[model samples]
Target chain A: MDLSDVRRHHLSVVLEHLVCSGPRSRAAIAQETGLTKATVSTLITDLLDRGLVQELDTPTAGRVGRPATDVGAAGHSVGALGLEIDVDEVAACVVDLTGTVRTVHRHTAGNRDVTARTVIHRLRDATQRAMADAAHMGIDCIGATLALPGLVDPNEPTLFVAPNLHWFDADLRSLATQLRLPEHFPITMDNEANLGALAELRHGAGQQFDSFVFVSAAGGLGAGIVLDGRLLRGAHGFAGELGHVVVDPSGKPCACGARGCLETLLHSDVNPDELARHLADALRTVVHLIDPEAVVLGGSLAAFGDEFALAVADHLHADTLGARWHPCAVRRSTLGADAALVGAATAALDRIISDPTIVPTRALAH
Target chain B: MDLSDVRRHHLSVVLEHLVCSGPRSRAAIAQETGLTKATVSTLITDLLDRGLVQELDTPTAGRVGRPATDVGAAGHSVGALGLEIDVDEVAACVVDLTGTVRTVHRHTAGNRDVTARTVIHRLRDATQRAMADAAHMGIDCIGATLALPGLVDPNEPTLFVAPNLHWFDADLRSLATQLRLPEHFPITMDNEANLGALAELRHGAGQQFDSFVFVSAAGGLGAGIVLDGRLLRGAHGFAGELGHVVVDPSGKPCACGARGCLETLLHSDVNPDELARHLADALRTVVHLIDPEAVVLGGSLAAFGDEFALAVADHLHADTLGARWHPCAVRRSTLGADAALVGAATAALDRIISDPTIVPTRALAH
Candidate 1:
């Protein structure tokens, strides 16, 4: 790593430590990061100067040396606006550095039938309200994220396709332009499933796992592929597409013109035991491919709850050729419907913390 | 990243630049890595001292300032032993720092119904022969990777399940112990599909793509999921079990007991067009999920050649929503059936060059 990269990585590490572990002295950070005390002090001081960390006036007791002054993440003034454009709802919220949800506004309506212009305007209203709400809370919103239910170009904030929303090639970034956020306050546009997986990993069932599949079954079956604590957004950023996987080559046709897709099999009329068995069967392919630590079913699928868990268990265990298919744990999403909003917020906050330059207003003004 | 981690990262980067981009002077490296000339010099000196790099005699002109000494990866003396235990054959080879495949020995035979002990013995023979061949070439074998046909526990280098070999939870480290190469000469055991994908990505069809699916179809269909240039080995090192993906919920039963799995469908009796259609169906799922740049068909499936490509292309292009399903270029694996062997070799070579400590026999002795 270069000198600048070293500084950046250290800054991120120190900030993460503070946010996750609460206040800690420089010595504690050094021990945790395996950096020298001098280096840790330098990084922490740099962060403090950047307003990313705060010195706790109250001294901490536990230490190898003198009672050391504690420092914690101080990016309290900066929050992120997270917006999700789903088939069933248009959700917006503000998330702080500690990942606490501050203000949440949800517009529950069928997103499928809405015109692109109307939805964008509605989203604009929600975003403005979210920003206004954050301002009311005295938190300066820096970065924002618009999580959509479709394939997105990570490099471009353009919605390539939203089968559920019936929006294709819609320039989602136009909303950012309308919002008039500064260029440096980067806005990320991505699949809601990806962010939902990230949120679950950070604050929900996946906290214990570095690798797991987060399946968000709503209007469609979307998967958030997390390997090694990192969400897998393939080369084109269209990953975790569980809904389109052909489960039955001869079954019903799909929106993508495919037959026997997993999406077609998942419906309200489907039997719970049969749905669980089918879901488990589909999941087995994922399990066989990426033997994950666990499969956390999120979104509307979370409604399946314990019954779904039991059915998945039965099918997964059925694969046991004595020990070849030792079933991994199956669980429901703890965040339920809020996974996407929380994840979008977390992703934006992470970007701001990792590179404060992106949080333009605060960095330049400070 | 701490001081040591920083040093390690720079060392790997420098060595990679040398091996991949050919030799470069310290000034060029500094420019490329955005490191100070002094830092590059220190890192280069450390590598030279460790005998992982050597100062090149010919200094080139395009460099700024003085024609600084050009250094390149000097681990040609150390090599990696790569072994592939497949359902159809046992393959082993020695790969050097420049990724040159030196000695290859393939024991072609049906791998089904073999005892783990017997297969291990055969692999040991091939591994010993490959190492002996490398020794004859005056190169020292430093690290080894054994690629198998099932789920692997990365932490233990043990086989979790090899449905094709009927090996379940078999302690594969026994091969390492039985071969008894060296204490510090690290050994990696992983699924063949993962290795095959890595091989294809490194040396064959996938170099152009940061993400792609490598389908190794022999007796069964296995996918190696690569996303954003990193291979996805789910939590248990068992990501990419495409063969077990339920293709038909009520089709033929598989070894894993699931009906209509991709594995059960890949039999010789299935027409080539039908097989391609089935494979295309599976590839569509991956495409919708990750939107990879290309899908490279490897292993026995490559034998189908243009016929397979035509079928996949036909099906993929059939989804002509014009935007939702943009058919990514699909082609046969350039490495064909040799992909797994090459991948195993490349993976091992990568390990040795990245960390010379694993080259205990050469690094320590020298």
Candidate 2:
């Protein structure tokens, strides 16, 4: 392999280590990565030159050697613009490389009843506000990520089905054209629940554990599955469609054409107790399928808090079930409505830091 | 890093390519891996010396250079031992490195009625017979992997529970002592469904897709979650316990003590029609959550064939179910009862071939 490619790989490994572990000395990175001290030093210097790392001036004593200076990630300068098109509103935010949602711009609108043109324009308005805010704050935009509540095809930039939004086969690339986005910026579209899980794992109720199920209940039910620190998006990128699960064989027919689908039950004009019962039954399905550490309830269920948890635990114990004892905790979503926006920003920043070549083309700061 | 460690990593890369993508020339491998031609040559020579690869007389017609000789994997020389402990039987088999089951030996017993000691004896007897068969057939024994229909923590060598087998926290390491296995021949204990999914992904219905859910139903429903190719066991190793999901709030209480659970519905003394309806309802939960390409039915349901497919399809379509046309095909288990055993063999062989240092310590062939 060429020296440059090798160097890039080493730099990636060192940068990933620093990002995941907070900060470390060059000698510590070398020891952890099994790389030589000289190689790690060269990589650290390169990262500094690229505006990806900064000297922390924190001295750390080595077990067998002299102390070394520590370096940390430089996350303040570069930022990611994350936008979301929800049924209730269009939201936008700028998140720095440090995984902080620095600014938020939200506009309330009944997006489902509006035309696709109206929705796109509203999203454009939010993006403009977010972009201007980032510009004023001197945070350079790395890239943009749009989150939607739908089954997005991983192979294409298309939202295949957002039943709640009543938008089918929505082409995001053309929509970006409608928004008049810059040519250098690339857009990535994904399911909203997936982004919520990323945000929760990074900075929400799921921060304590490496794996959990992020259940977003708004106009419909969706689950973002994270296991072993990775999101489990199926082959078709339609993995976590938890709302469509059958709650009753004889219940109401859902838009999915299934009798007794969980979403139809959740949306029924029922009392709070009845609503919690329906939601819990749906959650029981998730717990049985994937016994995660916690089920982080977001969207509509976030406000219920203890009412929701007690109801779900009343029927099926979140922690333990059966003779085998499969235990899981139930908690409210930490980020709530902002999870998707924050997660999109995290993803964009992640892409830029991991693959620096894209940074120059996408990030205005670089 | 030392030259040898670097070579091992490159060797792993080259061998992984060969194993996954079939045979390729040194020049082709160098090009594909971004390794130098000289480095590829050195790694190839090392693998050949280790009996992991062999050169063939088949020559490739190059577009510009002289024809190069072809090489392929040496699989027959090394074999893995797979064993299984289920409610109905204790089984064992030997599989070659190329993913072929050379021998199968199984003993039928009412495992659920028997004590843990009795089941362990039956498993030992089965392993002995299978090991003898492998020896007689000139197949080398690569360490054994034991599959149990229960929850197994990765950090512990124990079976947490096998409800059908009436087992709770069965100690595998102590049981290995009773089986009299050699010290270096490490025994790995995992959930039967996880192993079944691995077998299916490699040789069964799941070979076509990188992601799908393998549902193992016998005494209970268990899910083997394969996402982006890796099996997802949650942080606590208690994932994929699908039978525990509540189906009918008014239904009978399960061993997990939840009323109207999926397992309770499945186990009701019902006709094939009723059984299929229950199974379909349960399958619907999996499809809604994971959205796999296909749901490969295994365990007791494998024998039902179209009866199971028709019944499940009666209420819920296997694929294309709703306003969201999620078309996932339905297929029966290819290996049936042989899945867990075969998958265990695959795991054992995979471990040995991928990490050569473990080969000599465990596998008799090395």
Candidate 3:
């Protein structure tokens, strides 16, 4: 690549850093990014001209040097849309460059009609409303991300299988195409747990740790894992299926036709009210094995409050080897129902900045 | 950074490509590395003068230009040693830049006290013998890697636990210090399962896939997972504790004081013959969950033969979501007892090349 290409990419990178790592001075950015002061200055100038970044009035003073002007992402300059399709509901949200969800919408779907076309229609209507609201707010929607609960074949956009939704061999891309989205816009999709993990990594409790696991206890239990600072998507994009892992050989029968899966014991179907008790019993078995830094609880079950997180933590502490003094902290989701939406927005924003050619699009009307 | 620093690092990258991805002519290397032909030629000449690479006699004909000679790593220039300490045995091997194991030594420890000091002493003696034998056959060892079963804190050289061998918090670097090893020689220590996964990634069934899980079903059950082309060492280096994942809520009690871990189901406690059936049953559960690209049967359980693998495969097929089709392939480990040892060698080789300042130490004296 030419020097100009490198410089342009660096500019985008600086913008991303500003958005992800919060505000910082030019010198601080240079130290964090390992880019020279001259290069950062040049990139910062370019970003400022584009209205992507702005200098704050507050100056940062340190022991060794003069006060430096702090800079941060210009939240209004760029926006993204996040769409989440659960078994019973569809959620949409518009997020700004700094991962702030500015608007949210939720629509309950009819029971048991989760076919590919039905989901496509629901998504189309939801996106249209979300985009309209975003426009009303005077913000441009730059990209959209879709999150689903199932295995997504990364190589093939259309191939997905969500057991709870009874969706199999569905062509998501074809459905999106049928919606007639905007020409320049692109729709990105990923597994819900993966996106949840990404959200935690970028914006939640997982930010401090290089590796962590995020468990979503909803209709079914799933885990999003981060290792070496990256999402651990397996060979077929089927990793983090912690629910399917057998916690009992002859326990309850799971929807996946397996007996004694972790999901069978911890899923909402077992007993929504008693989920904390069930999760505590189940987690007592896993804590000693991995000894993770922390285990985060999200999804609808996390809404049960600190009681659920505490119950699991207590059991883990009691069951771990040597009564390991350090119990993996269990925290509830901070974003509530809007987490997946926020994650989807983050994913969309990441996709756009990583590859500027990607354009934002709206699902086509039937 | 200066332009020359970037250029030099870029050249080193080209040299690494030539070493790892086999040989290429100067012109081809230039195109692939995006460096100019003159730059490539100069680097290749410097490398050749240092005996790091050799030019092939055969010239290849191309449609667009004259034939050119291919240059490749000088296999005999540098070598690495890998040592694996198991509960019942110890294995050592020497490997070249091309990942070819040239010499191997296996010794029966027969349930001896395997403290860090004792293990280091044994390794030093074995290394001496192996080096002498290799000298007679014409081979050299430039670096060493040690693979041990435990929760290895990467930031520290002590092991948290090696349940099978009954070692806890064993100081590895102290043992190295006591041994008085050679200066400027690299030595590395890592978890056995992680090393086994690394070995498979570089030289075994996983070479073709970017992500896969290597389950070590031996005296204990553990896993080494690779995601997005990197090993998944969780926060605090305890990521792949697959054996500890609860597989049974009310089942047998695990040695880790947990109830029904995969290790409890899979490992052979007293005699291999006594636990053969249990091993097969546990392997079935493992195959049903992750559905990895390939299930490699290694450790002591692999010695049981294809019947064990086929039996597990049959159970997996019968219990999987879609019993109509097999989800993943099953295979026996080709490296057998030496898998972890070879992996250690690979890790040592990587460390030596990445940081030339590493010093190799002699084995600890009893």
Tens digits of per-residue lDDT for model 1, B221-246: 78887877678776657677777666
State the weakest 10-residue window (summed lDDT) of model 2 chain A: A357-366
**Deviation of model 2 at B12, angstroms:** 3.2
Per residue, candidate 3 scores C-alpha lDDT tens digits across B128-196 of: 666666566555566677788777766666677777888876767754444455665556678898888
- In angstroms, the error of model 3 at A162 is 1.9
Tell me the DockQ of each model, to 2 decimals. Answer: 0.57, 0.49, 0.39
What is the Cα-based lDDT of residue A314 in candidate 2? 68
TM-score chain B for all models.
0.87, 0.85, 0.79
What C-alpha lDDT does candidate 2 achieve relative to the native structure?
0.76
Pick by DockQ: which candidate is best?
Answer: 1
True contacts kept of 3: 0.42
Quality of model 1 by C-alpha lDDT: 0.76
DockQ for model 1? 0.57
Q: How many angstroms is the interface RMSD of candidate 2?
A: 2.9
Task: Tell me the TM-score of candidate 1's A chain.
Answer: 0.89
> How large a fraction of the reference contact set does each model reproduce?
0.81, 0.58, 0.42
Evaluated against the true structure, the overall lDDT of model 3 is: 0.68
Error of 2 at A214 (Å): 1.2
Docking band of candidate 2: medium
Q: What TM-score do all the candidates reach, one by one?
A: 0.89, 0.89, 0.87
